[model samples]
Target: MISYLFGILSIKGKFEYFKMFLVLLSSLPNIDKRIKSIFQTIESVEDIVNIIIGGGAASLEKRASYSLEWLEQNGRCLDHIYSRLSDIPSAGRGAFSRRFIKKGEVVITSPLLAFQKSQLEEFYDKNNKIVPPPDFESRQVILNYCFSHPKSSLALFPLTHAMLINHASVRKGSNRHPNAKIRWATDHTETQKS
Candidate 1:
């Protein structure tokens, strides 16, 4: 049955559970790879991987929504199943980034932001140094540190999906409840003054 589901048969039906099931199935392969990579890049792989996954998930969500509708209309149960598989894993909208940064590590914000050579020399002179000693070793260490950490780090995959789902639910609720008042004090006096 599993093979058949994963293979040639395309089932099309409107059952919500079935839809969810399919989404889960299709997304399994990706979920496994993502989970495995989290450990492999333990030191500094979070930022780039999270960015890529987040972007991919965003694109996939749009495609899945459209595909889900098409599958419902065409009686393509297989497509529905695939959609469910993908949906289940990606239910959490912002999971990827959160998971990537879960590990306790420092991330460099900007590699290019550094002190100029002249500034370093001036500091050395002010400290009463006759000749500024070369700081190549320290500079190399700093470079290595920066390279080992990135700003946009994320937590592990399991944690990431949970976050994504929560974020998605919040976004969905906001969309549905547009009338929910957001408190804001309008500066009517300022407008009039202007």
Candidate 2:
């Protein structure tokens, strides 16, 4: 198969080479299946890639209607946020920056999971903090990714790379301070405003 492809590439005329290459590609077994799988991957992951890499819509409507559902079903953000083993002493996977992020710049636009505290009693501890999953002791804490107040029963959980961010532990003696901060997104279109 490789030899035939090389033969097609060696053809003298450009048009002839292209035509022969197309024919060779079509003759390859499972080519259609491979192509279909590629397109399926693109379709499933398009929205978040667009939002992260292409700066697609961050409107409340789009996040609530599309991004949030994708995250819930896929158990991952649709964006291009990459994760790897954390450099921290006890942490697991941590989100890393793909590009240089300027201070105060919006690095992520995530949708929130707002619900009453009682809705997640099984996940919370007596201190009102979320308990680490039994199987994931040193990973990012689910409660830290959420927003709750002493006076309010509602918790707003951000769904995006924001959830993947692990806090810098002062006890680790790293002396690093948080470089990013989460702020309300108020610039969404009027119809999509929260």
Candidate 3:
């Protein structure tokens, strides 16, 4: 799984970098004024970075949601894996899951792919009654395991944020960043109240 995640991120990173390079190249021909062009290039780079960050954040949120859904459905598989290994009475028993979950955490710190809404809905339907959310410490351990394994920071961040927000809202706090908070607050008071 770690390898798979890494493979995906590598491919994505290359594509994103390549796209930015091409965009930069395109602007090179239009820069008749060197100083102005330099500023333009800087602005272009900033725009690209912002796009990547925004897209990455969205992707991460989606992935986290999907991961939670997957866990809900496939928790039994995890339990089974633990049970089988521990029964062997070996010192290494239960170590694999713990290690895997830890690696997942690193992956979650980055951008993630989109979550499948239908899949999430299905999982929700299957588990109609709300169960207690998983423990934050344990959940974090699992996320750390996944994040560390293979995914890029750009791909895991949003997903991780989503999971943390959902499972441990009190701990995670608001999703809005400080910049967003100011904008939202100003808009709410000025427009909505008016």
Return the lDDT, model 3, position 147. Answer: 24
Query: Which candidate's lDDT is highest?
Result: 2
What are the lDDT figures for the candidates, one per model?
A: 0.28, 0.44, 0.28
Lowest summed lDDT window (length 10), candidate 3: 176-185
Model 2 is weakest, by summed lDDT over 10 consecutive residues, at 132-141
Report residue 192 deviation for candidate 1 (angstroms).
68
Cα lDDT of model 1 by residue, 83-112, tens digit: 112233422222222223322332111111
TM-score of each model, in listed order = 0.16, 0.45, 0.16
Question: Which regions of candidate 3 fall more than 4 Å away from where they truly are?
Answer: 1-125, 148-194
Q: Which stretches of candidate 2 lie over 4 Å from their true place?
A: 1-80, 122-141, 169-173, 190-194
Q: Which stretches of candidate 1 lie over 4 Å from their true place?
A: 1-37, 45-162, 167-194
Measured on C-alpha atoms, candidate 3 has an lDDT of 0.28
Candidate 2 lDDT tens digits, 53-133: 332234122343447666566343335445555676545445667777666877666656565655433343334454433
Candidate 2 positional error at 65, Å: 13
